[model samples]
Target: MDLHKLYHVHDFHSRNFLDTYFSSKPDTPFSHETLMYPMEKFHNAFSTGDIKGEVLIDISLGPIIHHLYSAQEYFRDIILLKPTDHCIIEVKKWINSRTGAFDWSHASTFVTEMAGKSDQCEEKEIGLRSAITHVVKYDPNQENVTAPIELPQADCLVLWGVLDVISKDLDDFVGNFRRFSKLLKPGRCLMYYGALNGSFFVVGGERFHIVKYNESNLRSILSDEGYVIRHLEVSQRIIESDLIDFDSVLFCTAYKEQKI
Candidate 1:
């Protein structure tokens, strides 16, 4: 068992620690290669060709273009649906707080640097044409948005960080998906991440909780809502997680059932 596979879902403490652990455990599932396994799956999914006219939706777009481009390159077209620009502001503040310079930024700067690029990409290119589309407002309460914005009929959608906000109340949240599925074409796919266990703590006045649910339960809920499980990845946090807090995480993908 390789630890890389585990990292695909749960992150580890540190690269050095991971290297040492793997060096010692020739046969341990927690090997270094096993730790980074999830990334490979992610990369593979983004690298492999999928059907044409399929769209890829990424929920949180902070300035990570490499991964976005990878997905776009793999899927042909990609759209980023950000719940709020507040996330970008918060990210800016976080960077300023650590770096002591409001003059520098992350994703915003990346966007500026990559200005005028198209949002579409080709297989030979490993980058997004325009890279990201900011969803200024997200009405999780509704299936489609109230604003005059449109998303392509995504064959695949990446539900990255929105699960915590959307899954707050399972019944309502899942119901929202029921209505929202109409916005997508038949057989659209969604990829997402969630915590299997944990508590939501107050961070910057936003209500959040670590989503802890087993695959069986998650599948049951989504299945009842006309969704089917494609893949389930369980992961833990590495020592230096980008997340301010939390030690572990899990991710999964589900596809909307094609209409009868």
Candidate 2:
């Protein structure tokens, strides 16, 4: 790895991440886990120079905005949409990563935002003019409707973050996946990353239970939902200190199969 690149990456994390959230006052011992993997991948995509237009619809704050701020030329716009405002650390990540291109001319970018919980895409027509639109929504109750939740028709990449806690039952999760598959045309990719039900997490300063699913269960759910597994990335628990002891996290990308 180039030391210069690494240094910049570290600075982006420290100055932009820790300094903003943890504050530089008491020197809060903050670590980078959630944003590291995604940001590193973003850099990899840029290095290949194969990317064109990119639109990031982040669900877990806005780290994608941070990783590609000045380092990337592909993204024309970075819209900040949130379901809740508790995503302080995530917002900080965006602020730090957006140092460059903050004042760039986005008049022709065709980028915008939504400020509520549910993203009603299927009900509206945002057209297919954009290049990439990343969506992150995991709802079980609103299953198989095929309306309002359909994402924009662009070079789309839908992500399901924290899937384990989105629903009370596995069938609900599977149902949401099924409807999601219907919305996505064939050949597009969707990435789902979260801990299985056995996983633990801290939300609103309180620990709660999450629905767990192992690799086999995940495969079965996807297979039943009309998807073909294209790629898979799995990792052990990232933050397992005195605060939390979750088992692990899984990241998988699947394509909408041609056949139902």
Candidate 3:
């Protein structure tokens, strides 16, 4: 059974996906891993003042923007690329402050508190919203993921839980990485977050396929693609769940040494 095909056939409910894994409450292990962990990593990485750039390209799974709360402070412009219309609409809804948009106050509060600016929670959300200048749809299979309108080479690229979901095999993963690299300027940064050794994750009770690979595989791929790894952190799963099966979470920040 082609799991990728099944993923396209099913309607990916953006709201359901959020409620399942990214609830405002961080009581569950799933929320901790998916929401707080990434938030903390991004906060720490950007705090170094190394990842700041003029334009940041975000290619993440679903309509999730919790991880970008800190990034907005560093990047002048943010462009989001979504694979599905469902995801795109959800993002636009939030950008427009439309009805039924996912409340990201919890994420904003977390980031503000981390920066010792708990009183600036609303200011953080406003900054993120203003920084996100564009939300475009992209096709992962294409040679130019954002074709037709050539985007300026970004100073930083964020690939969060996207490669594993789109890649069918190890080779495909490498190819996707190369394609994504073209969007970033040489000597810039690429911040990646993904599940390590993950095969599947359930959203709206529908299991979606993810390419399983270990830390060594990811490290080799990044090195082969001419990226210099600066920071790599992996945390073992705190709890087991029927919704998703994975050994650990990996957060990496690397610089593109040269054009891939």
Best by TM-score: 3
Estimate, for each residue in 1-260, the C-alpha lDDT of model 2 and write its tens digit.
11121111111332243233223233332223344444344444444544334443333322333333322245454333333223333444334434531221121121211112124322111222121133233333455332355544323343434345444457756764564455455665555666654543342334444555788899888887777886676666555453333466566667667654
Which structure is stronger by lDDT: 1 or 2? 1
User: TM-score for model 2?
Assistant: 0.55
- Model 3 lDDT per residue over 1-260, tens place: 54543343354888888888888764554877888789999999999998897999999988999899898878899999988888889989998889999998988988999999999998888889999999988877788987777899999999999898888888989999999999999999999999999888888777888888999999999999999999999988887889887899999999999744
Each model's number of backbone clashes?
A: 25, 8, 0
- Tell me the lDDT of model 2 at 93: 34
What C-alpha lDDT do the candidate models reach, one value each?
Answer: 0.46, 0.42, 0.88
- Whole-model lDDT, model 3: 0.88
Worst 10 residues of 3 by lDDT: 2-11
Candidate 2 Cα errors over 4 Å, as ranges? 1-32, 41-140, 143-151
Q: What TM-score does candidate 1 get on C-alpha atoms?
A: 0.59
Model 1 Cα lDDT, one tens digit per residue, 45-88: 55445423456665532222233434544555565554445444
lDDT, residue 162, candidate 2: 35
After TM-score superposition, what is the CA distance of residue 151 in candidate 3 from its true location, in Å? 0.6
Error of 1 at 191 (Å): 1.6
Maximum-lDDT candidate: 3
What is the TM-score ranking, best to worst?
3, 1, 2
